[model samples]
Target: MEKAGSPLEQVRSSIAQACKRARREPGDITLVAVSKRHTAATIEPLLIEGHRHFGENRVQEAAEKWPALREAHPAVQLHLVGQLQSNKAEEAAALFDVIHSLDRPSLVKALAKAFDKTGRRVPCFVQVDVGDEPQKGGCPVSDLPALLTQARESDIPLAGLMCLPPAEIEPAPFFAFLDKLARDHGLEGRSMGMSGDYETAIMLGATHVRVGTALFGERPS
Candidate 1:
């Protein structure tokens, strides 16, 4: 098993290799280090290694973990990748550079209110439920156009689309679907892919990939 330092090295190597395989410049794809289940101590080395983008999957946990780290590493760009609750929208808006899970209008309204209160336009990605999983929280692909329109009418800067593929299907098609959706909607960033299928994601034109275990090893239970 790789130690934390080696894991970071390996992740950098993988990013380089993936970019090369995709015939994209190494800088084309941004690496969002998924920092949930990781303490700031474990993340510090990566910050030293010049990794600036970090992603968290929960509002409460990330709200607790990021403050001091943000103070020490002010250049770090934090992203919220989990299911965001309306009640937590203000706190999330204040912290995250990008919110990657806008699945509902209520959450969008709350984020808009937060942005209004803070006077900051928070960039966001609408989550599309490509698989239609009942347990998941995302606007259906059919509902996406309306949602994107709603976002455009709101104060939130609609940046892109995000999705989690059905557990059984290959992620490539789902990612390609997102890429096409973004192009159709005139959006820019596509935040798809993760530790398991990020290479496929790159091939499908993922602008940002959220990688956790592949970079940090298994989460400590």
Candidate 2:
């Protein structure tokens, strides 16, 4: 007899609650609903519900769908939330409104060139490997300062820092560490947190949270 809330409503409610607990204004957090691997048809409902920020993992995949999606919903802000190859810098810069995986010097140089050519200064969050996992996409912790310097020299618009805490363990410490790193660097945007641990991230001062499954449900096999 009682109706269940839609995923968007539930996610928004959770974020609001998290902000309340964190003593932060909900408007301060940019909720990036990661639409990676999901088709445009699957994403339309959230768009219709007025959620405009979305993240994609691959350039090719996004190139396939986002043009039309953006045409239909003109306010949509597309984010690149995966590892970006230097070779695809031009395309990525041309397409995405924001980028969250700027990890290395080469990619920074590439993005700078792309931005100059496109004349579009897309903001980017430098990804840091806080967990130091060899297989992950972020640069190692010690490399962040140099990376940020390179990004600045290249004139890349540094939004802040991002990180993927190791899975299957407590993530709060990692989030807190990222917050400290951002403060040390005088960066305002901390693009940390995801579906599972976003609440913890918000409490630790994440300015952006990339949420997927929690908003769109699990991907099909």
Candidate 3:
């Protein structure tokens, strides 16, 4: 196995390689450090290294973590990258800069209501079921057009699309498909891929890559 470098070094190298392969500038992509299951202690160094964006899976955990983190790093941006329950919509709306797993209409409606009450337009990314994994929560590809239509017609400000590729397949094709979908719909962002496959994501036009283990090391079991 290849040895991993320091988190910031790894990110810099990966961004360089991805940009080279993609024929795009490294600055075009945003690296959203996935801090799920990681303590603030583990995240501090990366923030100090100028990583401004972090993604978390659980709202409760993030709500507990971010306030202190914000005091330390006032410019940091937080993203919610897991399945969001409707009951937690308000908390999520208040905490996340972007919600990357808006799969169903009910959640969209819940988010809209939350935004209405708070008077904040929480940007969202529609998750596409590209792999059609039964275990994943996302809108089926066939339904994406209609979903995009609905999202566009609302006040929610649909930012773009996100997806999790099948574990066995190369992620490039799926990432490209998502890029195409976004272009077809006039969406401006694409959030896909993770630590294992983020290079392919960047090569295929992923505006945001959720990097966890590659940056913070594996989650403690």
Candidate 4:
């Protein structure tokens, strides 16, 4: 944990340092303060500080917390960073500015119709199973190309690829693999990294980092 500054301030400073180390611009990286399990009361301070990018794990929770928050600060960018259920496609598409969990054919089909119905083309990241973790929700590594094609055919905006590195492992290689996959697919955005390894992700070309604990502390059990 940072010893000298508030969480948000410390994160910003770390992002700056990481960008410096990577020879990249800090402005090029999007910091998504993951606010799931946190009350709107806890999140409002970050909003008041001009932290406009936030992420939520569930559509219903976000719907309950953010409408009032966005009403107060209209420019907030909400990202759906959790595994989205195909049934919740409509609500998720309606609520989030970005959808980072595009992983399967059913979801692609569902979101296509949802986006058409809502007339909102939300930018999406194709979640790749970088760790090949069966417990995870991403598409299999071999299935990525087909999924990308499917999403493109549906006219979904392919922002990039995302992954959750298998926990309790060195994450840098996984981040690098996701970045390479993005490049090979002609995508620019790499939604890799979390609170623990975001700086490494930045150095490896992550355009979006989903930070939660380092900012808000661990989610309460």
Q: In candidate 2, which residue ranges exceed 4 Å CA deviation?
A: 1-4
In terms of lDDT, which candidate is strongest?
A: 4
lDDT of 2 by residue, 1-221 (tens): 11258888888888999999999999999999999989999999898888999999999999999999999999999999999999999999999999999998889889999999999999999999999896888988898889999999889999999999999989999999999999999999999899999999999999999999998899766
lDDT (Cα, 0-100) at 185 in candidate 4: 90
lDDT per residue for candidate 1 within 88-196, as digits (tens), equals 9888888889899998888878988999987778789899998888488888989898888888888679879998998877878789888999899898898998998
Query: What lDDT does the true structure give each of the candidates?
Result: 0.87, 0.93, 0.87, 0.94
Clashes of each: 0, 0, 0, 0
lDDT of 4 at 31: 99
Query: TM-score, each model?
Result: 0.94, 0.97, 0.94, 0.97
Task: Go through the candidates in order and give the C-alpha RMSD of each one to the true structure.
Answer: 2.4, 2.2, 3.0, 2.2
Q: Following a full C-alpha superposition, what root-mean-square deviation does model 4 have from the true structure?
A: 2.2
CA shift of 68, model 4, Å: 0.5
Instruction: Please give, for residues 1-221, the per-residue lDDT of candidate 3 as tens digits.
Output: 22346776777688888799878998878889999989999998888777789999999999998999999889998999999999999989888888999888788788888998888888899999998884788899998887777776667878799999999888888999999999998988999979888888888888999999988888988
Preferred candidate (lDDT higher): 2 or 4 = 4
Residue pairs of candidate 2 with colliding backbone atoms: none
- Rank order by lDDT, top first? 4, 2, 3, 1
Q: Is candidate 3 or candidate 4 better by lDDT?
A: 4
The TM-score of predicted model 2 comes to 0.97
Looking at model 3, which ten-residue stretch has the lowest summed lDDT?
1-10
